[model samples]
Target: MSYLVLARKYRPRRFEDMVGQEVVTGVLRGAIEDDRVGHAYLFAGPRGTGKTTTARILAKALNCVKGPTPDPCGECERCLASDEGAEFDVIEIDAASNTSVNDVRELRESVGYAPVDSRYKVYIVDEVHMLSRAAFNALLKTLEEPPSHVKFLFATTELHKVPDTILSRCQVMRLSPIREEQIAGRLATVFDAEGVTAADGVAAELARRARGGMRDALSLADQLLALAGNSPQLADLARLSGGAGLQELLGLVDALGAGDRAAALDAVAAWAGREGELAGALLDVVRSIVVAGVCGAGSPHLEGGPAAGEALLARAKALGRGRLELMLADLIRARERMRHLAGSERVVLESALLELCTLEATMSLAELEARLASLEARLGGASVAGHTAGPASGGQLPVSIQPTPPPVGASATRSVQQPTGPATGPATAPGAAPRSPDTPQPAPGPAAAPALEPWKALVGALDARHRTLADLLRRSGKLQGSGSMARILVSKASADEQALLADKRSRRACERALSGAMGREITVEFVVGDAATPPPPKVEQDPFTRQVADLFDGHIEEP
Candidate 1:
């Protein structure tokens, strides 16, 4: 006795027996019952998606002894013969081999003859697009106007290759790939019929591996039952699919979420040879994490089922949504990179996994903003304090702001609420609080104005003018006073910057910017700050500067 594969043994016997193609089957059933059946019908879809099976069902329905009923009597001699492809009138041709004009000419010649013992002389041609142009042309007339007792059925995986002339005469039915849920549902029924005891998620995983093909799903199920002897588990299915088991994959994701780089690298090393499959498995889990985050833990879309979703929810919360999204994007790009590579697939996959592992230490955008604000507050208060502590001996205090460029066209306004006013006022005698508003007010003393917040905005505003005089002033000098601003170009210049700033044109340029902002005729003065004052603290905190300095084995030559 020959062993029958599940794909053949469970082939759809009728229109209603098919899976995941309700729309097409419903139309076909209605057409048959309403006596609106077309002379030539074309079925198009992916391989193993019930294209030929549909054609045979329709043929059996038309040629049955019951005379063109949608529900054919399978026991009839004509129906049985048609099922076996041995009927005298129901002809089945494989266009892949018989694609010549002579074949079509023979078919055309035979169309004039009557059926042996059926309602219509049926012709089912599989992969009809493989026919030569000449063969299609030879059959065009016969196909368009076949005899009343003749009918034609054509099936093709590539509908685009079928010429429009042949297509215009035939009715087209497009079959869609079955969904994983639908495939798994069908597999459950098959498992019961076969008396197989498969674990939960095993059939679901097999259906997923089928990539939307029911026949492929059935074939994989048969192979799995044969290999594992009817008691297959998720691990067995994972091994068959050339990827890690769900638990192993979950562990890798956990390592990544916890920022355990070595653990993640070790896992990557363990799956070195199957990097592509490992990448796919990792992507699946990451996708589940995203789905769990957005669609909730109990959503049915989770690929690993509820157990995997529960496990993934913990990691999803640990890594947060943004980092998980970035990690998912990285995995997608890594898979694309390894698509055509002949070797070195492990490097790309490992790098992506390591990056995801490091995602735990990375700060979210909101967190980074909070840290920057805190630092800005501390640094701003410190700088304002240092400036307020003036020399008081006819000498001025230096207020240096940290140089950070506001991106182009951005608002550089920063409202620093602090009394950075000049310390030139005589200290009011201690405990002297009796001066009421009604009392005669003491005349204000004369002193230089303090560097205001708008000055920093002016400097930061010139980010578009990088590596120029504007950049030099932002990096070194400080703008003080209001309308008659003092443009103190410091001694930190590299000789060329000094020449550029000391130039009259540069002074006028600064005065114009300051004047327009201050709404008055601004006079600029260039002077280096006295050595008694110090530069702003933490001004050299830009890591890029430090990296470039290290790379060049040099320091920022500030005087």
Candidate 2:
């Protein structure tokens, strides 16, 4: 007898045998038990996900010889015949091949008749979405209102292609892809039943490669078994799939995470030189890193040895979740581009590996913002100390000069008395002097100019420190007064300059400089005023004028 492939041998024989589709199974079971099964049912999902198989089981459950039982007894002739694909009452058609109006018309006509031997006539159309538009129109009425004795099961991977009109008439059951872990467990059972000795990691690897498809998993296992005689080792399975050993792949990831470009490039080059599957190797590495990140260290999901798994976990931690997600995206894009590139697989794989290795792990936006704040704080502090000093000449002061008391017994004391003559004002009390008519009395010696304040000192310091700023201050007539309360008359140009210096750091620096220059602390205050213009230039004699005078017979005197 020819050897039966794993896929066919492990096909679900009953509802209990179905995996990863408990919802659909339960609904169908309840329908069967309640005898409320719809006339037309549509099963839609991906390939190898048991759409066609479930259709067959449903047909058998309805057409069994005993009755329309929820659980068909396989011992009965009708059930046995249906399972073997030889039942006369159960008609299975490949819609992909028989998609014509004529075919649908014939099916419609046949549905009118009752079952010859079974309880109900069942028609299972696989890939029903492949049917032509005319075919769908021909069968629409029959599907919507089929005879009591006729049952229809339609399976399609592309449900969108099936018109909404047809979908509305049928009870649609959406089947999901089996989970990876469930697929692995099912494959392990198959391996045990087949007496195939698979290594520790082989079953899980095959299941992952299957991508939630049981048929594909079994097919992969069959090929491995064929290649390795009977007892397939993990290495053999990996070799057949063109995947690298988990340890090697993890090592590559570790190098990348550590930012060791050389090591990463070397590993990739070595893998590329080998005549194995570069794409598979790349995917395997990405998958292992992702799994490690999700599952944490010592996860059983990793196919490699414990050390390799631990390494991958470490790399995942170092690279972080954000980096790992970006790497996955880049790998997927590279894989797609590789198909179109006309170069050696090694070159393509190396390019992708190098890119991954050089990937700079990015911080979260929050973290970046925190860092920026820290930098700004440090800069502010430094600017306060280094950039905020008063001018070399010290800051301006508000002059309010008080006359020094006259030396004991001198006539200068009489000068403090008010003038009595017409040329001067009436005599005032001692220490109170009246203004002289001709001299205006100098306003009590300029009110003894006020002491210089800290802010003025700081501005002075800034002017001394920055030449450009000093030039700007001089040009704008910002320099004013001679004491603490001295105001820097700010013209429009100086106001614009002040606006430029309005940043928090710059303002703080100026404050610090002012504080240092003045004995007391001070703050900045702006006042607007028109700037004083410079007088017209006057012509002056040069050194050449004296030299010409010495050369001539006459002296060069001022005109």
Candidate 3:
């Protein structure tokens, strides 16, 4: 086996050869030049961010026969051996394989020896986090105060696992994840060196797939080279990665935006066995959509090609910020749930996507508030759809969902009562509509003409927004009330409609709709009864009552 993989072949030999680690490499170079080098250094960061490589480079620099210069003469026998991690004096210890007290004792015993031939005996410990507690305790004395001739260099992906005493002895240098641009640039250089032709975007795509690890990027590139031979493309990268393609994810987003659940599910079926990947990729697309909604395309920066980013922006604008955020949250939650939930990951992911696609046109919180304000203003002068709700005196139905005091003589249902207060609310003009129930007001005077059909107006208003809910409510109950309170008398038989409104999210949407129709803040209480409002049965609750109780976190009681 004469072939060397690109990761080993291109390992950085000198500090300058490292990529995306200038802060760390710069500090080490400065330390070497100023001779302020510490006895022990702990390199901490994610794997493949050059922890071991940087430590090795530091060893080579210190042991170089060129008078301890930062730039080692690669031609020197010691420097060459250090580069290959074969230098007898510069020992490389993999703590993972030697995580025992005996191993540390052996290391401690050897630390007293003088450098075989190099200027200093460098002990490079990789994955030092894997050392057992006993091993760590045994090595503490040596790590704290090694001989003046010895240098200790440690590297770990999990810095927290290293004990504090051990940490205090070492000058810990935190290495950050490599940036995508730097990784891509490194990949391009490697490809150029290997005489391989690749698509313009192939390097960048591979870099992104690395997720901030130079070694990972190179490893992915090696796979790409093996599959495509000498001329790799983005398609090869996508297939080899086992992740959902951008276009497929985009199609899923498009279907979600269009409220096409089947289409969205169909679009994601290609990655059924790879639900984690599909969900993760969809999360990225939704995040981009959210970013595009907040800012323009490539506002902060761009990751993919221009066309893809612009398309994301267009889809974001079409989907609107509210829906994009909801979808983003859903995707994130689904991805997290996939980690713990049993059965097929596809089931968890697809259910979430389906739920998102079912979302009706939603407005941002700001927009919802603004629309409510505008509706109140409109109520001051005109009836909604030319109709106003009659006082509770009329034979109309009762409809209430807001959290207000229980109706007079009503004790079966639990309600969060507003503390009683004076009529601080401004007096309603001879014929003005109320603005809010924040302050309870006197019931409106009896209508001169038969109370105009306000329920009609309410249904009509909601029809434009939540057609399904509004239609169900129209058949299941009727809105009736005035001043500070409104009630919907729901027929006990309309269980389907009752269940729909009982949903936590659906209830909120319905409330928003009702608020607009009423022109003021509405305290809606749904009375699940007809003419003879009987007391609730407390002994044996029905499924509908149980569900409502669960949704509201309340219980039923007899009057």
Q: How do the predictions measure up, each by TM-score?
A: 0.55, 0.55, 0.66
**What's every prediction's RMSD, in angstroms?**
16.8, 24.8, 9.7
Model 3, global lDDT: 0.68
Please report how far candidate 2 places residue 258 from its true position, in Å.
8.7
Q: What are the per-model numbers of colliding residue pairs?
A: 0, 27, 13
Model 2 spans with C-alpha error above 4 angstroms: 242-288, 298-311, 330-360, 364-559
Instruction: State the lDDT of candidate 1 residue by residue for 1-559, as single tens digits.
Output: 8988999888987888999999989999999999999999999998878998998899899888885888988899988987776888888999999999999999999999998788888898999999999999998979867899988999999999999999889899999988878889999999999889899888888776666689988988887888887878876775564445667777888777654655766876777677887888788778878888888878887665777678778777766777788788878987997886647576656556645543323344465445444434533653444445432222343444332122121121111111222333245321121112232222222213334443543443332222265556755665434223333434355423433443444455455445444545555645433233233225322322222323233222221
Reference-based lDDT, each prediction: 0.66, 0.62, 0.68
Q: Using TM-score as the measure, what is the rank order of every candidate, best first?
A: 3, 2, 1
* Model 1 ranges off by over 4 Å: 96-113, 129-139, 160-167, 241-290, 311-364, 370-559
Residue 427's lDDT in candidate 1: 51
Residue 344 of model 1, lDDT score? 56
The prediction achieving the highest TM-score against the true structure is: 3
Supply the global lDDT for candidate 1.
Answer: 0.66
